[model samples]
Target: MIALLLALGSSLAYGCADFLGGLGARKAHVLRTVLVAAPASLAVELLLWPVLGASFSPSAAGWGVASGAASAAAFALLYQTLAIGPMNVLSPVAALVSAVLPVTVGLLQGEHLGTAGLLGLPLALVAVVLVSAGHGAGGARPSRTALLLAFGAGAAIALQLVFLHQTPPGSGVAPLIVGRAVSSAVTLTAAALLRRRLGPEKPVYAVSAAAGVLDSVANLLFLLAVRSGDLTVVAVITALYPAGTVLLARGVLAERIHRGQVVGLGTAAVAVSLLALT
Candidate 1:
Protein backbone atom coordinates (compact mmCIF):
# COMPACT_ATOMS: atom_id res chain seq x y z
CA MET A 1 0.00 0.00 0.00
CA ILE A 2 2.82 2.38 0.80
CA ALA A 3 4.45 1.62 -2.50
CA LEU A 4 1.15 2.15 -4.25
CA LEU A 5 0.74 5.54 -2.62
CA LEU A 6 4.24 6.51 -3.67
CA ALA A 7 3.46 5.51 -7.22
CA LEU A 8 0.30 7.57 -7.15
CA GLY A 9 2.23 10.59 -5.96
CA SER A 10 4.75 10.02 -8.68
CA SER A 11 1.95 9.97 -11.23
CA LEU A 12 0.66 13.31 -10.08
CA ALA A 13 4.12 14.82 -10.24
CA TYR A 14 4.72 13.40 -13.70
CA GLY A 15 1.40 14.73 -14.92
CA CYS A 16 2.38 18.18 -13.75
CA ALA A 17 5.72 17.84 -15.45
CA ASP A 18 4.11 16.81 -18.73
CA PHE A 19 1.70 19.70 -18.58
CA LEU A 20 4.47 22.18 -17.86
CA GLY A 21 6.74 20.69 -20.49
CA GLY A 22 4.01 20.95 -23.10
CA LEU A 23 3.37 24.53 -22.15
CA GLY A 24 7.06 25.33 -22.51
CA ALA A 25 7.38 23.54 -25.83
CA ARG A 26 4.85 25.93 -27.29
CA LYS A 27 7.32 28.77 -26.85
CA ALA A 28 10.65 27.10 -27.64
CA HIS A 29 12.20 24.43 -29.81
CA VAL A 30 11.53 20.89 -28.62
CA LEU A 31 15.19 20.10 -28.24
CA ARG A 32 15.77 23.36 -26.45
CA THR A 33 12.94 22.53 -24.11
CA VAL A 34 14.54 19.17 -23.30
CA LEU A 35 17.99 20.62 -22.86
CA VAL A 36 16.80 23.03 -20.23
CA ALA A 37 14.50 20.50 -18.65
CA ALA A 38 17.24 17.87 -18.48
CA PRO A 39 19.65 19.96 -16.45
CA ALA A 40 16.96 21.25 -14.18
CA SER A 41 15.92 17.66 -13.56
CA LEU A 42 19.51 16.68 -12.93
CA ALA A 43 19.95 19.43 -10.38
CA VAL A 44 16.93 18.29 -8.44
CA GLU A 45 18.15 14.72 -8.39
CA LEU A 46 21.60 15.83 -7.36
CA LEU A 47 20.15 17.69 -4.41
CA LEU A 48 18.49 14.48 -3.28
CA TRP A 49 21.48 12.30 -4.13
CA PRO A 50 23.63 13.35 -1.22
CA VAL A 51 20.78 13.09 1.25
CA LEU A 52 19.67 9.73 -0.07
CA GLY A 53 23.29 8.58 -0.10
CA ALA A 54 22.81 7.00 -3.49
CA SER A 55 26.02 5.46 -4.74
CA PHE A 56 27.15 5.09 -8.37
CA SER A 57 27.02 2.15 -10.76
CA PRO A 58 28.23 1.93 -14.33
CA SER A 59 25.44 -0.42 -15.36
CA ALA A 60 22.85 1.88 -13.86
CA ALA A 61 24.50 4.81 -15.61
CA GLY A 62 24.29 3.00 -18.92
CA TRP A 63 20.61 2.25 -18.42
CA GLY A 64 19.91 5.82 -17.44
CA VAL A 65 21.60 7.19 -20.57
CA ALA A 66 19.71 4.83 -22.81
CA SER A 67 16.42 5.60 -21.10
CA GLY A 68 17.12 9.32 -21.24
CA ALA A 69 17.83 9.20 -24.98
CA ALA A 70 14.63 7.30 -25.56
CA SER A 71 12.73 9.83 -23.45
CA ALA A 72 14.23 12.69 -25.42
CA ALA A 73 13.00 11.21 -28.65
CA ALA A 74 9.60 10.57 -27.13
CA PHE A 75 9.25 14.16 -25.95
CA ALA A 76 10.29 15.59 -29.28
CA LEU A 77 7.84 13.45 -31.16
CA LEU A 78 5.06 14.13 -28.65
CA TYR A 79 5.45 17.88 -29.06
CA GLN A 80 5.51 17.60 -32.82
CA THR A 81 2.33 15.58 -32.70
CA LEU A 82 0.67 18.07 -30.40
CA ALA A 83 1.50 20.82 -32.83
CA ILE A 84 -0.42 19.02 -35.55
CA GLY A 85 -2.92 16.83 -33.70
CA PRO A 86 -5.71 16.81 -31.16
CA MET A 87 -5.33 15.98 -27.44
CA ASN A 88 -8.05 13.36 -27.58
CA VAL A 89 -6.10 11.38 -30.11
CA LEU A 90 -2.54 11.93 -28.92
CA SER A 91 -2.74 11.52 -25.15
CA PRO A 92 -4.66 8.23 -24.85
CA VAL A 93 -2.73 6.37 -27.51
CA ALA A 94 0.55 7.36 -25.90
CA ALA A 95 -0.59 6.52 -22.39
CA LEU A 96 -1.89 3.09 -23.40
CA VAL A 97 1.23 2.03 -25.24
CA SER A 98 3.43 3.18 -22.40
CA ALA A 99 1.47 1.33 -19.73
CA VAL A 100 1.01 -1.91 -21.67
CA LEU A 101 4.69 -2.48 -22.38
CA PRO A 102 5.85 -2.20 -18.80
CA VAL A 103 2.98 -4.27 -17.54
CA THR A 104 3.94 -6.97 -20.01
CA VAL A 105 7.55 -6.72 -18.97
CA GLY A 106 6.66 -6.95 -15.30
CA LEU A 107 4.69 -10.10 -15.90
CA LEU A 108 7.54 -11.59 -17.88
CA GLN A 109 9.96 -10.86 -15.04
CA GLY A 110 8.07 -13.30 -12.79
CA GLU A 111 6.43 -10.59 -10.80
CA HIS A 112 2.93 -11.41 -9.56
CA LEU A 113 0.36 -9.88 -7.24
CA GLY A 114 -2.35 -12.53 -7.28
CA THR A 115 -5.89 -12.18 -8.64
CA ALA A 116 -6.71 -8.73 -7.30
CA GLY A 117 -3.68 -7.01 -8.73
CA LEU A 118 -4.19 -9.00 -11.86
CA LEU A 119 -7.75 -7.79 -12.21
CA GLY A 120 -6.63 -4.25 -11.42
CA LEU A 121 -4.24 -4.32 -14.34
CA PRO A 122 -7.00 -4.38 -16.93
CA LEU A 123 -8.92 -1.73 -15.07
CA ALA A 124 -5.85 0.46 -14.96
CA LEU A 125 -5.46 -0.14 -18.64
CA VAL A 126 -9.02 0.89 -19.34
CA ALA A 127 -8.65 3.95 -17.15
CA VAL A 128 -5.66 5.23 -19.05
CA VAL A 129 -7.42 4.91 -22.38
CA LEU A 130 -10.69 6.37 -21.18
CA VAL A 131 -9.05 9.22 -19.28
CA SER A 132 -7.14 10.18 -22.35
CA ALA A 133 -10.30 10.20 -24.45
CA GLY A 134 -11.03 13.61 -25.90
CA HIS A 135 -13.94 16.05 -25.88
CA GLY A 136 -16.21 14.19 -28.20
CA ALA A 137 -18.92 12.23 -26.45
CA GLY A 138 -19.36 9.74 -29.22
CA GLY A 139 -16.06 9.46 -31.06
CA ALA A 140 -13.90 12.43 -31.66
CA ARG A 141 -11.06 11.59 -33.93
CA PRO A 142 -7.63 13.15 -34.01
CA SER A 143 -5.07 13.21 -36.81
CA ARG A 144 -3.34 9.90 -37.57
CA THR A 145 0.01 11.54 -37.10
CA ALA A 146 -0.95 12.54 -33.57
CA LEU A 147 -2.00 9.01 -32.79
CA LEU A 148 1.29 7.67 -34.13
CA LEU A 149 3.42 10.06 -32.14
CA ALA A 150 1.44 9.41 -28.99
CA PHE A 151 2.05 5.70 -29.41
CA GLY A 152 5.72 6.35 -29.91
CA ALA A 153 5.89 8.40 -26.76
CA GLY A 154 3.99 5.74 -24.87
CA ALA A 155 6.33 3.01 -26.05
CA ALA A 156 9.33 5.03 -25.06
CA ILE A 157 7.85 5.72 -21.66
CA ALA A 158 7.24 2.01 -21.09
CA LEU A 159 10.78 1.20 -22.05
CA GLN A 160 11.90 3.77 -19.56
CA LEU A 161 10.01 2.06 -16.74
CA VAL A 162 11.42 -1.31 -17.71
CA PHE A 163 14.95 -0.02 -17.74
CA LEU A 164 14.66 1.93 -14.52
CA HIS A 165 13.24 -0.99 -12.58
CA GLN A 166 15.86 -3.36 -13.94
CA THR A 167 18.49 -1.37 -12.16
CA PRO A 168 19.63 -2.84 -8.83
CA PRO A 169 18.46 -1.30 -5.61
CA GLY A 170 21.15 0.77 -3.76
CA SER A 171 22.66 1.67 -7.09
CA GLY A 172 24.20 5.11 -7.07
CA VAL A 173 22.83 8.34 -8.50
CA ALA A 174 25.25 8.03 -11.39
CA PRO A 175 22.58 6.44 -13.56
CA LEU A 176 20.26 9.39 -13.23
CA ILE A 177 23.06 11.91 -13.70
CA VAL A 178 24.37 10.10 -16.75
CA GLY A 179 20.87 9.79 -18.09
CA ARG A 180 20.25 13.52 -17.75
CA ALA A 181 23.61 14.47 -19.24
CA VAL A 182 23.24 12.16 -22.20
CA SER A 183 19.65 13.20 -22.68
CA SER A 184 20.69 16.83 -22.80
CA ALA A 185 23.37 16.13 -25.38
CA VAL A 186 21.12 13.90 -27.45
CA THR A 187 18.23 16.34 -27.34
CA LEU A 188 20.54 19.16 -28.41
CA THR A 189 21.81 17.11 -31.32
CA ALA A 190 18.27 16.30 -32.28
CA ALA A 191 17.40 19.99 -32.23
CA ALA A 192 20.26 20.68 -34.62
CA LEU A 193 19.35 17.76 -36.84
CA LEU A 194 15.76 18.97 -36.98
CA ARG A 195 16.75 22.63 -37.39
CA ARG A 196 14.75 23.58 -34.33
CA ARG A 197 16.05 26.59 -32.46
CA LEU A 198 15.71 27.86 -28.93
CA GLY A 199 13.65 31.00 -28.89
CA PRO A 200 13.99 34.06 -26.67
CA GLU A 201 10.88 33.22 -24.72
CA LYS A 202 11.23 33.20 -20.93
CA PRO A 203 8.05 31.25 -20.28
CA VAL A 204 9.32 28.44 -22.47
CA TYR A 205 12.50 27.98 -20.48
CA ALA A 206 10.82 28.49 -17.15
CA VAL A 207 8.02 26.03 -17.73
CA SER A 208 10.29 23.48 -19.38
CA ALA A 209 12.70 23.71 -16.50
CA ALA A 210 9.89 23.25 -14.02
CA ALA A 211 8.64 20.24 -15.91
CA GLY A 212 12.07 18.67 -16.00
CA VAL A 213 12.62 19.15 -12.31
CA LEU A 214 9.26 17.68 -11.45
CA ASP A 215 9.74 14.72 -13.76
CA SER A 216 13.17 14.02 -12.38
CA VAL A 217 11.85 14.07 -8.85
CA ALA A 218 9.02 11.78 -9.88
CA ASN A 219 11.46 9.34 -11.42
CA LEU A 220 13.44 9.29 -8.24
CA LEU A 221 10.31 8.57 -6.28
CA PHE A 222 9.46 5.76 -8.67
CA LEU A 223 12.81 4.17 -8.09
CA LEU A 224 12.27 4.38 -4.38
CA ALA A 225 8.85 2.80 -4.75
CA VAL A 226 10.34 -0.12 -6.63
CA ARG A 227 13.01 -0.49 -4.00
CA SER A 228 10.36 -0.79 -1.34
CA GLY A 229 7.38 -2.41 -3.11
CA ASP A 230 6.17 -4.75 -5.84
CA LEU A 231 7.37 -3.63 -9.25
CA THR A 232 4.20 -4.84 -10.99
CA VAL A 233 1.92 -2.79 -8.80
CA VAL A 234 4.25 0.19 -8.84
CA ALA A 235 4.43 0.23 -12.62
CA VAL A 236 0.67 -0.06 -13.02
CA ILE A 237 -0.01 2.71 -10.56
CA THR A 238 2.68 5.03 -11.85
CA ALA A 239 1.59 4.61 -15.43
CA LEU A 240 -1.74 6.12 -14.48
CA TYR A 241 -0.27 9.60 -14.85
CA PRO A 242 -2.75 10.47 -17.59
CA ALA A 243 -5.39 10.71 -14.87
CA GLY A 244 -3.50 13.55 -13.25
CA THR A 245 -2.85 15.25 -16.58
CA VAL A 246 -6.50 15.11 -17.61
CA LEU A 247 -7.64 16.54 -14.29
CA LEU A 248 -5.14 19.36 -14.58
CA ALA A 249 -6.23 20.15 -18.11
CA ARG A 250 -9.84 20.29 -17.02
CA GLY A 251 -9.03 22.54 -14.11
CA VAL A 252 -6.39 24.79 -15.61
CA LEU A 253 -7.10 24.67 -19.32
CA ALA A 254 -10.85 24.54 -18.78
CA GLU A 255 -10.92 21.53 -21.03
CA ARG A 256 -14.28 19.85 -20.93
CA ILE A 257 -14.49 16.51 -19.16
CA HIS A 258 -16.16 13.84 -21.17
CA ARG A 259 -18.03 10.82 -19.83
CA GLY A 260 -15.14 8.59 -20.83
CA GLN A 261 -12.84 10.44 -18.45
CA VAL A 262 -15.21 10.05 -15.54
CA VAL A 263 -15.44 6.38 -16.23
CA GLY A 264 -11.70 6.17 -16.57
CA LEU A 265 -11.13 7.92 -13.27
CA GLY A 266 -13.58 5.65 -11.50
CA THR A 267 -11.98 2.59 -13.02
CA ALA A 268 -8.55 3.76 -11.95
CA ALA A 269 -9.72 4.32 -8.40
CA VAL A 270 -11.16 0.85 -8.26
CA ALA A 271 -7.98 -0.64 -9.69
CA VAL A 272 -5.86 1.14 -7.15
CA SER A 273 -8.05 -0.12 -4.35
CA LEU A 274 -7.98 -3.68 -5.59
CA LEU A 275 -4.25 -3.57 -6.08
CA ALA A 276 -3.88 -2.29 -2.57
CA LEU A 277 -6.00 -5.02 -1.05
CA THR A 278 -4.22 -7.67 -3.03
Candidate 2:
Protein backbone atom coordinates (compact mmCIF):
# COMPACT_ATOMS: atom_id res chain seq x y z
CA MET A 1 0.00 0.00 0.00
CA ILE A 2 2.84 2.37 0.71
CA ALA A 3 4.42 1.57 -2.60
CA LEU A 4 1.11 2.06 -4.32
CA LEU A 5 0.69 5.50 -2.81
CA LEU A 6 4.18 6.41 -3.90
CA ALA A 7 3.43 5.29 -7.43
CA LEU A 8 0.20 7.31 -7.48
CA GLY A 9 2.06 10.34 -6.23
CA SER A 10 4.58 9.80 -8.96
CA SER A 11 1.75 9.75 -11.44
CA LEU A 12 0.48 13.11 -10.25
CA ALA A 13 3.94 14.61 -10.44
CA TYR A 14 4.50 13.22 -13.91
CA GLY A 15 1.16 14.53 -15.09
CA CYS A 16 2.14 18.01 -13.93
CA ALA A 17 5.51 17.67 -15.58
CA ASP A 18 4.00 16.64 -18.91
CA PHE A 19 1.56 19.52 -18.70
CA LEU A 20 4.37 21.99 -18.10
CA GLY A 21 6.50 20.39 -20.78
CA GLY A 22 3.68 20.71 -23.26
CA LEU A 23 3.27 24.33 -22.31
CA GLY A 24 6.98 24.84 -22.96
CA ALA A 25 6.83 23.02 -26.28
CA ARG A 26 4.24 25.50 -27.48
CA LYS A 27 6.73 28.34 -26.99
CA ALA A 28 9.88 26.54 -28.19
CA HIS A 29 11.07 23.84 -30.52
CA VAL A 30 10.36 20.26 -29.40
CA LEU A 31 14.04 19.41 -29.10
CA ARG A 32 14.68 22.67 -27.31
CA THR A 33 11.97 21.78 -24.82
CA VAL A 34 13.59 18.39 -24.23
CA LEU A 35 17.06 19.88 -23.83
CA VAL A 36 15.84 22.26 -21.19
CA ALA A 37 13.75 19.69 -19.28
CA ALA A 38 16.41 16.96 -19.20
CA PRO A 39 19.23 19.08 -17.77
CA ALA A 40 17.06 20.74 -15.17
CA SER A 41 16.07 17.25 -13.99
CA LEU A 42 19.72 16.25 -13.99
CA ALA A 43 20.75 19.25 -11.94
CA VAL A 44 18.08 18.63 -9.30
CA GLU A 45 19.02 14.96 -9.11
CA LEU A 46 22.68 15.86 -8.62
CA LEU A 47 21.82 18.00 -5.62
CA LEU A 48 19.94 15.06 -4.08
CA TRP A 49 22.70 12.59 -4.99
CA PRO A 50 25.18 13.59 -2.27
CA VAL A 51 22.41 13.57 0.31
CA LEU A 52 21.59 9.96 -0.49
CA GLY A 53 25.25 8.88 -0.09
CA ALA A 54 24.62 6.25 -2.71
CA SER A 55 27.18 4.27 -4.67
CA PHE A 56 26.68 2.58 -8.04
CA SER A 57 27.63 -0.55 -9.92
CA PRO A 58 28.59 -0.44 -13.57
CA SER A 59 25.81 -2.89 -14.44
CA ALA A 60 23.20 -0.86 -12.56
CA ALA A 61 24.37 2.39 -14.09
CA GLY A 62 24.31 0.69 -17.48
CA TRP A 63 20.67 -0.20 -16.98
CA GLY A 64 19.97 3.35 -15.91
CA VAL A 65 21.56 4.69 -19.06
CA ALA A 66 19.60 2.24 -21.15
CA SER A 67 16.40 3.40 -19.53
CA GLY A 68 17.45 6.99 -20.08
CA ALA A 69 18.07 6.42 -23.76
CA ALA A 70 14.61 4.99 -24.26
CA SER A 71 12.93 7.72 -22.18
CA ALA A 72 14.70 10.44 -24.12
CA ALA A 73 13.05 9.21 -27.28
CA ALA A 74 9.74 8.80 -25.47
CA PHE A 75 9.79 12.32 -24.09
CA ALA A 76 10.84 13.93 -27.34
CA LEU A 77 8.06 12.25 -29.23
CA LEU A 78 5.53 13.06 -26.50
CA TYR A 79 6.44 16.72 -26.64
CA GLN A 80 6.15 16.71 -30.41
CA THR A 81 2.73 15.08 -30.22
CA LEU A 82 1.51 17.63 -27.69
CA ALA A 83 2.78 20.47 -29.81
CA ILE A 84 0.72 19.22 -32.72
CA GLY A 85 -2.53 19.17 -30.68
CA PRO A 86 -5.19 16.46 -30.47
CA MET A 87 -3.72 14.95 -27.33
CA ASN A 88 -7.04 13.17 -27.00
CA VAL A 89 -6.00 10.54 -29.49
CA LEU A 90 -2.29 10.23 -28.86
CA SER A 91 -2.29 10.36 -25.07
CA PRO A 92 -4.56 7.33 -24.73
CA VAL A 93 -2.48 5.37 -27.18
CA ALA A 94 0.69 6.11 -25.26
CA ALA A 95 -0.85 5.61 -21.81
CA LEU A 96 -2.49 2.28 -22.57
CA VAL A 97 0.52 0.90 -24.38
CA SER A 98 2.87 1.90 -21.57
CA ALA A 99 0.68 0.19 -18.96
CA VAL A 100 -0.14 -2.95 -20.94
CA LEU A 101 3.43 -4.01 -21.73
CA PRO A 102 4.57 -4.20 -18.12
CA VAL A 103 1.33 -5.82 -17.00
CA THR A 104 1.73 -8.51 -19.62
CA VAL A 105 5.34 -9.11 -18.64
CA GLY A 106 4.39 -9.43 -14.97
CA LEU A 107 1.63 -11.89 -15.74
CA LEU A 108 3.94 -13.98 -17.88
CA GLN A 109 6.44 -14.06 -15.00
CA GLY A 110 3.70 -15.42 -12.72
CA GLU A 111 3.38 -12.37 -10.55
CA HIS A 112 0.07 -12.07 -8.71
CA LEU A 113 -1.54 -9.89 -6.13
CA GLY A 114 -4.42 -10.09 -3.68
CA THR A 115 -7.79 -10.79 -5.27
CA ALA A 116 -8.82 -7.18 -4.90
CA GLY A 117 -5.74 -5.86 -6.66
CA LEU A 118 -6.36 -8.33 -9.44
CA LEU A 119 -9.92 -7.14 -9.93
CA GLY A 120 -8.84 -3.50 -9.87
CA LEU A 121 -6.13 -3.95 -12.47
CA PRO A 122 -8.23 -4.20 -15.58
CA LEU A 123 -10.57 -1.48 -14.35
CA ALA A 124 -7.59 0.78 -13.89
CA LEU A 125 -6.49 0.12 -17.41
CA VAL A 126 -9.95 0.84 -18.75
CA ALA A 127 -10.08 4.09 -16.80
CA VAL A 128 -6.77 5.18 -18.24
CA VAL A 129 -8.14 4.92 -21.77
CA LEU A 130 -11.29 6.85 -20.93
CA VAL A 131 -9.48 9.56 -19.00
CA SER A 132 -7.40 10.32 -22.06
CA ALA A 133 -10.34 10.48 -24.41
CA GLY A 134 -10.88 13.90 -25.90
CA HIS A 135 -14.21 15.25 -27.08
CA GLY A 136 -15.50 17.54 -29.82
CA ALA A 137 -12.88 19.91 -31.20
CA GLY A 138 -9.92 17.82 -30.18
CA GLY A 139 -11.64 14.60 -31.14
CA ALA A 140 -10.95 14.92 -34.82
CA ARG A 141 -9.14 12.01 -36.35
CA PRO A 142 -5.44 12.00 -35.56
CA SER A 143 -3.08 12.17 -38.47
CA ARG A 144 -1.21 9.02 -39.39
CA THR A 145 2.06 10.67 -38.43
CA ALA A 146 0.79 11.55 -34.95
CA LEU A 147 -0.44 8.01 -34.36
CA LEU A 148 2.92 6.61 -35.41
CA LEU A 149 4.85 8.94 -33.12
CA ALA A 150 2.62 8.25 -30.12
CA PHE A 151 3.05 4.51 -30.70
CA GLY A 152 6.82 4.89 -30.69
CA ALA A 153 6.76 7.01 -27.56
CA GLY A 154 4.62 4.46 -25.73
CA ALA A 155 6.94 1.60 -26.67
CA ALA A 156 9.99 3.52 -25.58
CA ILE A 157 8.33 4.43 -22.30
CA ALA A 158 7.58 0.75 -21.63
CA LEU A 159 11.17 -0.23 -22.37
CA GLN A 160 12.47 2.52 -20.12
CA LEU A 161 10.29 1.35 -17.24
CA VAL A 162 11.43 -2.23 -17.72
CA PHE A 163 15.10 -1.31 -17.52
CA LEU A 164 14.55 1.04 -14.59
CA HIS A 165 13.30 -1.78 -12.38
CA GLN A 166 16.39 -3.84 -13.22
CA THR A 167 18.71 -1.55 -11.28
CA PRO A 168 20.14 -3.22 -8.20
CA PRO A 169 18.36 -2.70 -4.91
CA GLY A 170 19.81 -0.22 -2.38
CA SER A 171 21.45 1.85 -5.13
CA GLY A 172 19.38 4.78 -3.91
CA VAL A 173 19.37 7.62 -6.44
CA ALA A 174 22.39 6.50 -8.40
CA PRO A 175 20.27 5.11 -11.20
CA LEU A 176 18.42 8.41 -11.41
CA ILE A 177 21.66 10.33 -11.85
CA VAL A 178 22.90 8.02 -14.56
CA GLY A 179 19.55 8.01 -16.30
CA ARG A 180 19.28 11.79 -16.31
CA ALA A 181 22.82 12.18 -17.59
CA VAL A 182 22.27 9.68 -20.37
CA SER A 183 18.95 11.23 -21.32
CA SER A 184 20.47 14.69 -21.44
CA ALA A 185 23.16 13.48 -23.79
CA VAL A 186 20.64 11.64 -25.95
CA THR A 187 18.33 14.66 -26.13
CA LEU A 188 21.18 16.99 -27.07
CA THR A 189 22.33 14.75 -29.86
CA ALA A 190 18.84 14.32 -31.18
CA ALA A 191 18.33 18.07 -31.10
CA ALA A 192 21.50 18.60 -33.08
CA LEU A 193 20.65 15.88 -35.55
CA LEU A 194 17.33 17.49 -36.26
CA ARG A 195 18.90 20.95 -36.37
CA ARG A 196 16.46 22.17 -33.74
CA ARG A 197 17.66 25.44 -32.28
CA LEU A 198 18.18 25.82 -28.55
CA GLY A 199 17.47 29.51 -28.77
CA PRO A 200 13.79 30.10 -28.09
CA GLU A 201 11.59 32.53 -26.23
CA LYS A 202 13.29 33.21 -22.93
CA PRO A 203 10.05 32.81 -20.95
CA VAL A 204 9.88 29.16 -21.99
CA TYR A 205 13.01 28.39 -20.02
CA ALA A 206 11.35 28.59 -16.60
CA VAL A 207 8.44 26.45 -17.67
CA SER A 208 10.63 23.80 -19.24
CA ALA A 209 13.00 23.80 -16.30
CA ALA A 210 10.16 23.32 -13.85
CA ALA A 211 8.90 20.50 -15.98
CA GLY A 212 12.29 18.85 -15.76
CA VAL A 213 12.39 19.06 -12.00
CA LEU A 214 8.92 17.58 -11.65
CA ASP A 215 9.63 14.84 -14.15
CA SER A 216 12.92 13.87 -12.54
CA VAL A 217 11.30 13.71 -9.16
CA ALA A 218 8.55 11.56 -10.58
CA ASN A 219 11.13 9.15 -11.96
CA LEU A 220 12.69 8.79 -8.53
CA LEU A 221 9.35 7.98 -6.96
CA PHE A 222 8.64 5.41 -9.64
CA LEU A 223 11.94 3.68 -9.06
CA LEU A 224 11.29 3.55 -5.36
CA ALA A 225 7.86 2.11 -5.98
CA VAL A 226 9.19 -0.54 -8.33
CA ARG A 227 11.76 -1.56 -5.74
CA SER A 228 9.08 -2.03 -3.08
CA GLY A 229 6.04 -3.23 -5.03
CA ASP A 230 4.92 -5.45 -7.84
CA LEU A 231 5.74 -4.07 -11.28
CA THR A 232 2.27 -4.82 -12.61
CA VAL A 233 0.57 -2.68 -9.98
CA VAL A 234 3.10 0.12 -10.06
CA ALA A 235 3.08 0.46 -13.82
CA VAL A 236 -0.67 0.37 -14.08
CA ILE A 237 -1.12 2.88 -11.30
CA THR A 238 1.46 5.31 -12.60
CA ALA A 239 0.08 5.07 -16.10
CA LEU A 240 -3.00 6.88 -14.79
CA TYR A 241 -0.90 10.01 -14.93
CA PRO A 242 -3.00 11.37 -17.75
CA ALA A 243 -5.82 11.78 -15.24
CA GLY A 244 -3.98 14.46 -13.36
CA THR A 245 -2.74 16.08 -16.52
CA VAL A 246 -6.20 16.35 -17.95
CA LEU A 247 -7.64 17.64 -14.71
CA LEU A 248 -4.97 20.33 -14.56
CA ALA A 249 -5.81 21.47 -18.05
CA ARG A 250 -9.46 21.55 -17.23
CA GLY A 251 -8.90 23.67 -14.14
CA VAL A 252 -6.25 25.94 -15.60
CA LEU A 253 -7.24 26.13 -19.24
CA ALA A 254 -10.97 25.59 -18.80
CA GLU A 255 -10.80 22.84 -21.39
CA ARG A 256 -14.05 20.97 -21.81
CA ILE A 257 -14.14 17.69 -19.94
CA HIS A 258 -15.41 14.75 -21.87
CA ARG A 259 -18.12 12.61 -20.31
CA GLY A 260 -15.92 9.61 -20.80
CA GLN A 261 -13.25 11.26 -18.73
CA VAL A 262 -15.69 11.90 -15.91
CA VAL A 263 -16.60 8.25 -15.93
CA GLY A 264 -12.96 7.31 -16.07
CA LEU A 265 -12.17 9.46 -13.09
CA GLY A 266 -14.89 7.84 -11.03
CA THR A 267 -13.81 4.41 -12.13
CA ALA A 268 -10.20 5.16 -11.21
CA ALA A 269 -11.28 6.24 -7.75
CA VAL A 270 -13.09 2.95 -7.24
CA ALA A 271 -10.18 0.97 -8.61
CA VAL A 272 -7.73 2.60 -6.24
CA SER A 273 -9.93 1.70 -3.32
CA LEU A 274 -10.13 -1.87 -4.49
CA LEU A 275 -6.38 -2.08 -4.86
CA ALA A 276 -5.90 -0.64 -1.43
CA LEU A 277 -8.19 -3.22 0.06
CA THR A 278 -5.46 -5.69 -0.77
TM-score to native of every candidate shown: 0.89, 0.91
Regions of model 2 farther than 4 Å from truth: 79-86, 136-148, 196-200
Candidate 1 clash pair list: 55-172, 56-172
Please provide, for model 1 over 112-226, each residue's C-alpha lDDT reduced to its tens digit, 9 standing for 90 to 100. Answer: 7788887988898888888877774236566666677778878888877778787767775666777677777877677677663455554467788899989987888787787
In model 1, what lDDT does residue 97 have?
A: 85
Give the distance in Å from residue 35's predicted Cα in candidate 2 to where it truly belongs: 2.3
Best by TM-score: 2
Tens-place lDDT per residue, model 2, 182-219, is 88888777778777455645438888999999998899
Report per-prediction Cα RMSD to one decimal: 2.5, 2.1
lDDT per prediction? 0.78, 0.84
Worst 10 residues of 2 by lDDT: 194-203
